[model samples]
Target: MSKTISFVLNGRQRSVQVDDPEMPLLYALRNDLGLHGPRFGCGLAQCGACTVHVEGKAVRSCTFPVAQAAGAKLLTLEGLGTPERPHALQKAFIEEQAVQCGYCI
Candidate 1:
């Protein structure tokens, strides 16, 4: 019952076979697409660990339905930058030495 769900991920066109369209986008990104940037902090979407950019706005991927992301653009921590070229935020975190469970570090 997996249906093809296509969307733009990290500035690239991507698709996945999602049997449950209602499945959280977090699971699809992590389990199916192998993106560990967004973590399942709280299933209730209370925590901010599973935060991602949808259409350039930060949204909780844990409670976001996979089907709802169709045709949308997504950006995870992985998309922000790489070790050789970390994003500005990553550089700020490094400069301030902020520590929070090392989720995005």
Candidate 2:
């Protein structure tokens, strides 16, 4: 059965309908809404590739169910910074040239 879920994404309130409550939050962020900043790495949540801030705390999106994220605030890389005016993390990463293979960038 499909259920409608609402939450805050990048400080913006948004909602979507999902058929499965156990579906990973990463899929909802990337596939459903077309937010590509948080990438998919190990589905087992071993890697930190899908790290996103949920209610001001970092969470592994791959392991977090979409239903569990309802009504919570989510902050992905897109929310942390932008191309025109970047955030401190983005600025630091670029200034220090800390990017490897452009994966984290």
Candidate 3:
């Protein structure tokens, strides 16, 4: 059964139809919404790669259920900043050359 899940993504209101309410939030964010900031490091949630902020708390979207994210505020890497106006951390990373493979960055 497909269900409509709504939430605040990157400071914008967004919604997606999920075939499984229990589907991982990562799928909804990446596949459904076309947001690729979060990567699929490990589906077991052991890795911090798929981490995203949910209601101001860090969550592993790979294991986080879409139903639980409904109506919550989500923040991914893309939400941090843009190329023209990068976030403070993003600017610092560039200046310091902290990013390597761009997986967790």
lDDT of 1: 0.91
Backbone clashes for every candidate come to 0, 0, 0
**lDDT for each residue of candidate 3 in 1-105, tens digit (9 for 90 to 100):** 789999999999999998899999999999989987898997999978999999999999999999999999999999999899999999999999895776564
Candidate 3 segments whose C-alpha is farther than 4 A from its true place: 101-105
What lDDT score belongs to each candidate, Candidate 1 first?
0.91, 0.89, 0.92
Q: Please give the range of 10 consecutive residues that has the lowest summed lDDT in model 1.
A: 96-105
* Per-residue lDDT of model 1, residues 1-105, tens digit only: 779899999989999998899999999999989998899887888888999999999999999999989999999998999899999999999999987786443
| lDDT: worst 10-residue window of model 3 | 96-105
Which scores better on lDDT, 1 or 3?
3
Candidate 1: lDDT of 81? 90
Question: What TM-score would each prediction reach against the true structure?
Answer: 0.91, 0.91, 0.92
Runs of candidate 2 exceeding 4 Å displacement? 102-105
Decreasing lDDT order of the candidates: 3, 1, 2
lDDT of 1 at 11: 88
Candidate 2 Cα RMSD after full superposition onto the native fold (Å): 1.7
